[model samples]
Target chain A: MVHALGEIHRVLASGGVLIDLRPLCDRWSIEVFSARETRHTGHITDLPPGLEDDTAANRAMHQAEINGWFIREKEAFFPLHYVWDTASDMEKWIDEEWVDFVGLDEETRRATRSTWALGDADSRVRVKVKMLLTRYRAIK
Target chain B: MSARKDPEGNETKHLHQFADFAGKRVLEIGCGEGRLTWRYASASALTVGLDPDKNALRVARIDRPSDLADKVHFINSHAETIPFHKETFDIALLAWSL
Candidate 1:
């Protein structure tokens, strides 16, 4: 994509502003995708935990990698947080809306649901990200 | 060992190996609970501490030293994009921030 953009910019007018914006959302975005049942019960936090915490390091590395791609005119960070409080909120919406779904046993679902209620899922399910937005200008 | 003393009798190791910190803008990128933020605030008059987690920021602000807290500003933000003027910070400490 970077190569394609560079090639396109080569033919553009002398002063062209190339604004590239992409959400740096990670796997935790799934919290918003949980079923209504999971949502109401706060079971959405049942998502598997990451092996390593990659928040700080990943952000830095991503910025460095993108900087390598093009000449950055300006760079900024925007922080955001998304939260879903209950299992039913997630389970109802997801289960009813989807045509195909995977079924879990009542016991397992109950266990997961309880875990979310304890607030353990707050950090486990929610993802706070700093969106690194950079505006780059082609250097001829 | 440096021989720098605060209002108290405690001696601080002034890292003169670096430039002056008094009245200079500073940024504590990580600032986990203001452990080092308080340390730096003791010397520098103007310092800002940033962290993404609100809970951590609360702890840093509350438990931080009163003397240092007066000089430090705590903000809930990430390191990737610092919310300040460019080249505003003379000394940005990243104690375990990376």
Candidate 2:
């Protein structure tokens, strides 16, 4: 990643800017679950359970490393939501769009399905993902 | 311009505030299927969309708009090794590439 940043810096013209929008490695900020059996629940918090502190630490390390070559201009956070019309849509997204999130064991998959199950097969499901946005200038 | 709605699309508004490519040369890395090339190509003098995925590039080429045929070009290449001279482009957009 550092090398790629360096290459980008090298390729940019003087004073050229680099906009980076990446997922925050920290714990998710929100989780919403809705089902026919249970009432809709929207869990919004500063951090989610089972998230290790090391994830944020690693992200900071990466940002600092990039700052060594590029000048930090701005940073912000935003929520990106994905809405699936059906369970199959969600499954396909997890399998295709999000390759890294796939390949879980059957038990884990079942647990995830239960967690995100909707009112019916055609019901809507939404997942809110938090992202970090940073703008940097290539140091000439 | 309503930031409250379509927050993901609002990111582009922020990016535009930081960089404007009117009449400038632009290079986009990992430009999958030229999803964004059509958006900014009209404002740029030359826009090169590069990606390592041949299949995506093939689709991009086939979908190239006739009006943008002269302004937009697609290249099959990786971001690590951009096939262009140093300082060749006035702007380099990664736009969700990273």
Candidate 3:
């Protein structure tokens, strides 16, 4: 990851900007909602590898700043929500894409399905992820 | 299953505030399927989206806007080794791929 950061610095023009945007290594708050109401299921924590990688990413960025490759700047947090029409659809998508990083435990699955059953066709499943968006200015 | 992401456009709005994509050369790393590339690629002079996932790159190429044929490109590569000379891009965006 540090090598990637250095390569980013190498390829950027003087005074150019490097945007570091990613999800924080924390619990993902899962929610089931419909047109009229919403319910919050328990959060899902990231797997060991995902947690380790994000921690390393932070260290790499700090090293980049200390090396004077880029100057750290403003950063803010935002919620990035992924919504699916049904709980099963959400399960399938996550199983396919994020299975290695996150898992839908039996308890959470039950909660999601229960909350979803309360609504009509309007019910939707959501995974709300906290994202960290920050920028760095390349050093000349 | 169909999935809708970021319905509020918060990511786009924040991106616009943080970096002006207008007429700039942009490098987007880990640009999975270009789902986020289209958000700002329209405003950029040139965009090169790099990712190691060939399937995702193929999808990105197929789904790219017709008008951006010349402005946007997808590459199968790794972020550790950007395939370009020094000082090649005005902005490098690492979105969830670091």
Candidate 4:
């Protein structure tokens, strides 16, 4: 990953910007929401292989800065929502795509569905993804 | 089991806070299916979206907007060994791939 950062440094013009955006290796909040309100359902932890991947990515970015390839400029945290049309839809998707690390066991599934039931017809269940959006300046 | 991501447009909005895309050359690394690439490509003078996944690249090509046909291009490559000359882009965005 550090190698990739170095390559990015190489391709960018002098003082060009490098933007790194990715999900944080932490728990995601499951919620039921509409335009008016949001209710927290449960938290789903980002698990093993994926957690390790993101952690390594964080370390690599720090290493790249340490190497003086790029100067850290600014960063922000934002909530990225992955919305599902229905509670079951989210469960099914998680079973296939995120089962490796996302902990959506029977209890979490129940909690999410319970919250989904309390919302209006327009309500949807979503995973609130925590994201780190950082920009750096290439030190050419 | 399809899910809509970033319906609030926060990703693009937050990205805009970091840099201005208007008329600049941009490179998006690991631009899977060109999801984020399409969000900001129209503002760029030139945008290149590259990924090692050929299947994803194929999808990105298929999904690319018609107007961006001249403005954006997809490359089948990896970030570790980017196939480009030095100082090729004004901004390199590692969108959810770093």
Q: Which ranges in model 3 have alpha carbons more than 4 Å from their true place?
A: none
TM-scores of the models, in the order given = 0.36, 0.70, 0.94, 0.95
What tens-digit string does per-residue lDDT give for candidate 2 at A1-140? Answer: 44555666677788776666555433232222344443233332233322333354336436745576567777777766566554345556655655442222354345445655644544454445566567676667
Cα lDDT tens digits, model 2, B34-89, are 86677678888998988889999999989998998998999988777776666677
Q: How well does chain A score by TM in each candidate?
A: 0.40, 0.58, 0.93, 0.90
Q: Tens-digit lDDT track for model 4 on A1-140? A: 99999999999999999999998857888988888888888888667987888889889989999999989989899999999989999999888888876767678888888878877889899998999999999998
Residues B12-89, candidate 3: write the lDDT tens digits.
Answer: 888888999999999999998998899999999999999999999999999998999999999999998899999999
lDDT per residue for candidate 4 within B1-98, as digits (tens), equals 79999988998899999999999999999998998998889999999998999999999999988988998999998898999999999999998888
lDDT of each prediction vs. the true structure?
Answer: 0.46, 0.62, 0.90, 0.90
**What is the C-alpha DockQ of each candidate?**
0.02, 0.30, 0.79, 0.90
- Model 3 over residues A12-70: C-alpha lDDT tens digits? 99999999989875789989887788889877757888788888889999999998999
**TM-score winner, 1 or 2:** 2
In terms of TM-score, the best-performing candidate is: 4
Checking candidate 2 for backbone clashes, the offending pairs are none
Candidate 2 Cα errors over 4 Å, as ranges: A25-68, A102-123, B1-8
Error of 2 at B81 (Å): 1.5
Better of 1 and 4 by lDDT: 4
Off by over 4 Å in 4: A35-37
lDDT score at residue B82, model 2, on the 0-100 scale: 76
Better of 1 and 4 by DockQ: 4
